[model samples]
Target: MKIARIEVDGARRVGVVDGDRVQPLAAHVTVEEVLAATPAERTALVDRAADGAPRPLSDMRLLAPVAPPTLRDHITFEEHLEGSLKLLGRTAPPPEWYEQPVFYFSNTNAVIGPDEPVAVPPGCERLDFELELAAVIGRPGRDLTPEQAGDHIAGYTLFNDWSARDLMAPVIPVGLGPVKGKDFANTLGPWIVTADELAPFRRDDRLALEMHAEVNGVPLPGGGDTSASMAWSFEEIVAYASRGAELRTGDVLASGTCGTGCLLEYWAQAGDAAPPPLRPGDVVTLVVEGIGSVSNRVVAGAEPVPVPKARVGHARRPRPWTST
Candidate 1:
């Protein structure tokens, strides 16, 4: 079943997509609640909702399937990593990257839904979009094995990790994760396709779904990548993420950019022939087979607030309780 959240007036409603129509659930029913329901309970809810008159999907405004409580993104595509490393003049990923899947937390407050506007941050000229797939956790689990973790996933959705490459360039040397470069806008929508709905697309553990991206009706670089190229499977990523923390319902775990999914990789690979950075009014769309697409328009951002520059402070003398 393809589940979606739609905007009714100013309120949000959850529904199941049936072809061109939507089977609306109760007003109080939320995507999170549906995800947490048992298989039997979910079937019953859908059955009950189907009894009501359905609405045309094109007539309703779609929202992000869920407002995630926690958002984590993992770099699992070997080709993406290798291509990205070329920007730093490296031809290969770090040795540790091969040992385990690496991920970083993103700001949940920055999340947005389909057809929303994404602003280019102040002073940013290199705005880019990452094509990715995210899994929503349905059941809570801690220290789960790969086999157990597979049961925790409710479904998958298309994810766009919007980036400000110019703002990111300086932060990389600081040894910290992305700050203003990211956390500005992240997109997860059109809708969520239940895990069972995508069963035919699964090859072993990795999905064989074709992923593609376009900018302003023009196809972008890295258009032929597939989820099957991921070196670390979602099962492994979920298990590793649950090592010391709980995976809660509505929590999102995103597969990092597919190989050549972003303009950064295109720029790194095509020095002179690369396209210019995104500007106001440009539209970016990411599509994943079996899942739907999430598209956004770029708009001008508000002026930034100024702050004083950092300065050196006096060092404090060391305190010693015992000296040898």
Candidate 2:
């Protein structure tokens, strides 16, 4: 089943998406609440559809599926690893990366939904987009097994980890972040397709879905379906993420970038001339099969706060983003 949060006349309500119409819930339940519900409870929601008639899907604005309690993204694809390393001028991926799945926490407050505008920060000349798949946790669990992990997911949505590549270039070598580079905005949802809805597309381990990325309607560099790609399984990512802590309801975990899902990888593929940095008015879209797509329009906001240039002098390296 597909669920979404739509705003009609400035009032946001959760609903069930059936065909081209959205059956509004008698009581507005946030997507988070839906994720927290039991299968029986979720079924009850579908049953309640008869309580109110669905409105045309075209009549309302779609928002992020959930007001995420927390957001974490895992770097799981080898192609992305190799390409991103080169983008940062590294010869190879770090040894630790091959040993385990790595992820970073992102700014949940900076999220944008479908068709929303992303604000470009000042001083940032290079804005990029990361096409990814995000999994929304359905239940709370700790130290789960990979086998058990699959059951914990509620649904999937398209995720674009909007980035400031120019700002990230300098900080990556220090062995610490993708932070400010990733802090600006995270685009999620056109709608959330329940995990069961995608069960039909599952191949051995990865879903047999075609993933794609586009900028202003022009297809970007490398993007292929998931079956042949996605090195680490979503189960493994979730299991590792839940280790030593609880995976709470509504927490979002993302499959970093699929093969060449971001500009960093594309840069490694096509070099500096592949695609120009994102500018104001540029639109970026991320698409995943069975699931849906989320597109964000770039808009200029306040000049991004300036960062002091790093100058090396007298055998000491000074960092602009952090002092180490």
Candidate 3:
């Protein structure tokens, strides 16, 4: 079953997308509530909602399926990371990457849904899109084992991690940020496909779904990479993510960019031959077989405001010397 969150007469409502129409659930129903239910209970709720009055999908405005309480993106694909690192003059990832999945938290407030416009961040010239998959957390877990973590997932959805490569460049060397470069926007929606629905596609812990992306009307190079190629499965990534901190329902754990999922990887591979970065009016669409697709149009961003100088310019006060 495909579950969606949509706008209905100025308010948000949860619904199930069936064919080209949507069956609206009770106004009080929410994806979070559904996630909190036991599998049998959740199935019963969807079955009952399916009998409600249906609305054409075209008439409803979809929202990000969940308003994530927290979001973390992980780099799990070796191909994508190997290509991305080339731009930074590295040919291979650090040995530590192979030991474990690494991740970064993103701004949850910036999440948008299908067909929304992605604005070019101020002072950014190399705008790009990352085609990835996100796993939604259904049950809370802390320091879970991979086998246990699998049971905590509610479902999956397509994710677009919009990026500002120009702004990202300077900070990568500083060891701590992708901050201003990435905090502006992220796209997640179309709908969430329940884990059971994707059971047939499961290969071990990773789904064997075919993934593809296109810019404007042209298909991107290496567009048919499969989700099965991920070096670390979502179960492993989620298990690592849950360490120490509790992962609550509605939290999102995104599988970072697939191989050639972003222009940056292509640029790193093609060098000066790569097509230019995204511009206003450009449309980017990503598709994952079984999960569905999400499309967004690029738009111009607001002018950046100037900043004042720092009060203390690296001055260190002298302390009385103590003999060792």
Candidate 4:
């Protein structure tokens, strides 16, 4: 079932999407409540008993499919990684990447849904978009084996890990960030397609989804094939994530940017002459085959809210170091 969060009377409600209309899922008001259902109960949202009064899907506003819990964006594509590192002058994949699927924590509260306008982060001149797949955790688990990971997933959604290349460039080699640049706004939505509903797209454990993107009505070609290009599977990522902490309900684990998914990768290929980054007033639409698409409008840039300068000391003392 295509599960969605819809706004009614300024309130959010959980609904199951059947074609162009959405049926409220039982009496639930938010996706957090819906994710609380047992895996069996979740699949049952497709049954007649769960459908509420139908509303035209076009009339409903879509929100991030899962409520904020913990958002983990993992890098699992060698092509995207290689391209990013190449722009930094590297020739091959980092050894540590093959050692384990790596990820970073992102601000879940900052997420925007379909058709919303993304205000360019203050001070950011190089705003960009990333196309990826998101997996929502269904069951709570820790120490799960890779083989046991699939059952813990509730569904999938399209994710755009928006980036501020200018904010990220300075900290790339330090291994500590890409933080402020990424924490601003990440986009997800157009509804969550339950795993069972996506059976036809599954090949073994991977889904054969083709990702596509368009900017300002022009196609941005070269998106990598999801199943073919990913070096590590979601199963592996989930298992690894569960190693030190519990994978809980509503948690979003995203497949990192696909090859040619963002301008950084484009710059790696096209070099110093690559096109200017996303500007205010640009519209970006990202689509995953089988799942729907999300379109966001870029608002005109303003002096981005300035990030405080990094300083390690809390106290002010003129040349505090006394040769201790």
Candidate 5:
């Protein structure tokens, strides 16, 4: 089932998408609430909601499919890796970058739903968009084997890891994870599709699905093609991340930038010449097959006005600097 959280008449409710229409589930039984419930209870809840009177989808606004996620891991794919590396003047990731799955945590509070406006931060001259597939965790486990990892997946959704490339470049040289550059905004939704629905699309090299992104009405570079270009699998990423650590329900694992997933694929080296950064009134739409498209508008943050300094008389400027 494709599940979603929707706001209707100022109240939030859970629902399932049936074709273009949505059938409200329960006002209180959220996706997180269902995942935390026992299997029997979950099934019963689903049945009860199906039989109960439901509200029409057209009357509501779709919120993020899942409640706030506990944690998020950005998984790297080869096409994205190769494309980014070549742009940086390297042929491929260093031996260690690919020896095992690598990931980075995204800010939980920064997540927003489809159609929400993203605030472009101050000093960010180059903002880019990344189209990706996100995996949601259903069961909790630690040190899981690859086979065991597959069982823990609950669903999938479309994600857009909005980026400020200018702010990102300075911190990457220190080998630390992306901090302020990535914490600004991360977008997901349309809905969360159950694992059973998308299982056939997950494959060894990469899941075969068409993914694309558009800025306003025009398509961006690398905006067309199938997700089959990935060199790694989501299962491998889950297993690797769980090795010696715990994977819990409600955790989100993102398939990092897909090849041609962002403007970085073509303009990373152009430095100051990157396409005009996302600005107010720009609409970004990302579409992933099976799952639906997530569209958001970019709004300029309020510009801070400069305050003028007052001039002081010349008689009081003799303070000396002391070393600590």
Candidate 6:
């Protein structure tokens, strides 16, 4: 069953998407609430929700399929990694790069759903977008074997990890990791397609899927086959991630950017061209097969204002740093 969050009449509620209409779930359950429900109970609740008065999908705002997630783990796709390495002047990833999966923690608070507006931060002159597939963890498990990992997934959704290249450049030199460059904003969903529905799509080496992104109305990137490019399987990633840590419900694991998934691969070359990043009034739309599309608008940053100087009588002295 496809699940989504919708806002109708100014109130947010969970719902199941059917055709162009939505069937509201029993009240607006929090992410934790839905995760806590048993699979059988969850299925029954969705069925009952669908029995209610239906609303046109176009009339309501589609929020992220999953509620506020606890964490988002980004897994590297071979195509993206190879392309990125070449862009950085490396011949290929060091042998050890593929020995195990690598990931980074992204801010769950930065997530927004379909058709939402994302703020283009100041000083970030090179904004980019990545088209990816994200897996939602269903059952809780840690140190799970690869054979057991498949049962832990609940569903899948399309993810767009908006990036700021300019902000990322500085941090790379410090070796601190992708902190500021990545945390800006991440987009997910049109719906969370349950694993059972997507079972046929998942494969050992690659998921046979097509992905594409458009800037405004023009197609920017994507036309390649995902099945031919992926380096690892979702099961491997889940198993690796849960080695010692517990994998809980509502945790999102993302397939890192796809090859030619963003302009960073097609338009710009390292140290040569840094095109003007996404600005206010621009829209980015990402489409993945099976899963629906997610579109977001880009808005300008609010101008910074200056603060007035403190009054003379209220001025404070600086504290001494040296210990006597």
Query: Would you estimate the TM-scores of all the predictions?
Result: 0.95, 0.90, 0.95, 0.90, 0.86, 0.86
Q: Alpha-carbon error at 236 in model 3, in Å? A: 1.1
lDDT leaderboard ranking: 3, 1, 2, 4, 5, 6
Cα misplacement distance, residue 289 of candidate 5 (Å): 0.7
Off by over 4 Å in 4: 26-29, 36-39, 43-52, 305-324
Show the lowest summed lDDT stretch of 10 residues, model 6: 267-276
Model 6: residues with Cα > 4 Å off, grouped in runs: 28-41, 49-51, 204-206, 268-276, 303-324
lDDT of 1 by residue, 74-193 (tens): 999988888788888998999999998889999899999999999988778788899999999988899999998878988999999999988888988887888899979999999988
Q: Model 4: which ten-residue window has the lowest total lDDT?
A: 43-52
**Stretches of model 2 off by over 4 angstroms after superposition:** 49-51, 221-223, 306-324
Clashing pairs in 6: none
Cα misplacement distance, residue 121 of candidate 3 (Å): 0.6
Residue 297 error, candidate 2, Å: 0.8
- Tens digits of per-residue lDDT, candidate 5, 76-139, equal 7777777677756798778887677778888888888989999886677777888888888888
Locate the minimum summed-lDDT window of 10 residues in model 2.
221-230
Model 2 Cα lDDT, one tens digit per residue, 178-273: 657878899889888888889998888766678888889887754454734777788888999999989998899998888867776766777774
Using lDDT as the measure, name the better of candidate 1 and candidate 2. 1
lDDT of 4 by residue, 201-319 (tens): 88776878888778887767564456547777888899999998998988999999888788788787887636568887899998788888899999975676556987886986667
TM-score-wise, the better of 4 and 6 is 4
- What would the TM-score be for candidate 6 when compared with the true structure? 0.86
lDDT of 3: 0.89
lDDT for residue 170 in candidate 3, whole number 0-100: 80
Shift of residue 118 alpha carbon in model 3, Å: 0.9
| Model 3 segments more than 4 A misplaced | 48-51, 309-315, 318-324
> How much is 323 displaced in model 1, in angstroms?
12
- Candidate 4, lDDT over the whole model: 0.81
